[model samples]
Target: MMAAIATLLATTTALLFGAIGSRGGKEPTRNPEELVTVPAAPSKPIRTSTVRSQPSAPIPLANLPTSREPTSPQLALIPKPNAERESLLERRKQAGDTGILPGVGIPGGIPGAISEPSAANALVSSLGAGVRKAAAGQPDKAYALEQKDTLMAQGTSIRCALQTRIITDHPGFASCVVTEPVYSFTGKHLLLPKGTKVMGQYDAEPDSGRIGVIWERAITPNGVNIDMESPGVDNLGSAGHPGHYSAHWGSRISAALWISIFSDAFKYAGAKYGPTQTSTSSGIVTQDPFESNTAETIQNIAKQAVRRAANRPATVTINQGTIVSIFVAKDVDFSQTIKAH
Candidate 1:
């Protein structure tokens, strides 16, 4: 009983050891090999349709015209009639019955009016005769006589003929009296001293005797005395007699040369005096004889007067003196002493 029990115990122990060994072999001690991975080729890149924006159109200019430009219109050139034509027309109108009209058969008459020659023709003839007489006689006297006759026939006085004279004893200064013929009650006459630079005027009728106004006297720096006279007349018709007219007219005569000298002197005086003021009753300024402070007033006044005289275009005269009348104050009293020269 005891041996059988031992054998059974041994067999049990061996069966248990075999079962433990089978379990250890199935679990192994070392780790498994790592897996190697190969990367796939990159897929072809996807293509996108590119849409580029087109550039915008340019703008147009404002001033430029799309069509043809319009053209400009043309102007006309035409002339009008002059004053001579108008005068001829006026003469034609007055030819028939107007007694005041220029005499039809007179030397200056219209063409075909009478057997007598035209005034223009007669003037030419007289001029020719004067030339011949000057050639044949004492040239100076004959020429002077011819000029005197020409003045008388023209109903105009020579500058020398209108002299009312003033004499100056001064060494550097001189002057002469002047006179004008009165034509009508309302007519205004201009008078300039003998040897005064003056412009001339024309009259339909001849000038007459002079009437007295006032006298002026002045002394020069060199101790010379100057005397002057102003004259008036009732009517030029009263002076029709040649001797009577010439007697008074002779007093007003001045040398043309002297007159020119005096004009220059006057200009100098004006410049020295500065601009003179002329005012009316209302105190309104009328003439400014002076230019600006820098410019000369006297010269300006003289220039203005000359311009006015020349602008008349119909006549030739020294109009500068007229500016004095315009610029001088009407109400102001001038010293006779100052005016005399």
Candidate 2:
């Protein structure tokens, strides 16, 4: 029994060893949980000489064609012909060679061209001859000659009827003599109405020699007599109307006579009072103390009043007592005392 048991044990041990060797020979043993995987090495890209299958090849920026620099066109400087210069020189030569016409040599359009000792001598000769011839004739003929001479003298005076008529008929017309102030005064002063009719005559004074006429008129209501005289003859004929000798003679009287009288009255009033002041019914006051430069101030006030009056409704009437304040540049203020009704 012991031998038989030993044989079975040996067989069993040999079978176990054979089975272990078979399993080892069939596959290598490893732990699946601890198994490691390795990746293959990357491959290098292949270089090829084949052209792309599209259209044209792209041009390299450095190899592309460039634009050429611009060039200015050359110009030729040439001188122009001077036909006009030659023409002007010819015209000047022609003008220099020509002389003025006979009648035009003397400024007047008179018929005779006699050379006299002097203009004054010629005038005296004409007057004396005319007077002597008239005195030698019949009484009626002498009287007619005197009338004609008187009419001629009056027609040449500065205070001619035409000028006086213009002044009277159209006081506001620019060309009329009456548009400008005849007289200005500081206080309430009386003056002849602008269109008042007056007569003027020439007065020859040997001492205080003048060739102007005197205008005489009565101041209305006051009944004061006013007279205006013109400057000397030398100044008169220069006024362009030598034909109207009386008008030229009376020009100074017409322009300055009333102005002087008015200025005198203004001076008297100014001396009597301190300064002019005016007030409106609406309580607006204007002080006319003669500030150095009040013209601008007064102008600005008038402008503002005009603007305000324009903006007012149509129903509103611009009348006396209206109050208007003008604000000019900084620090300048003007208040107007309305005068128009």
Candidate 1 regions exceeding 4 Å error are: 1-116, 141-215, 220-224, 228-341
Best by TM-score: 2
**Positional deviation of 314 in candidate 2, in angstroms?**
61
- Model 2: residue 220 alpha-carbon error in angstroms: 4.2
Candidate 2 lDDT over 69-114, as tens digits, reads: 4444321111123643454455455334332222233555332222
What alpha-carbon RMSD in Å does predicted model 1 have with respect to the real structure? 32.6
Every candidate's lDDT: 0.37, 0.36
Q: What TM-score does each of the candidates earn?
A: 0.13, 0.15
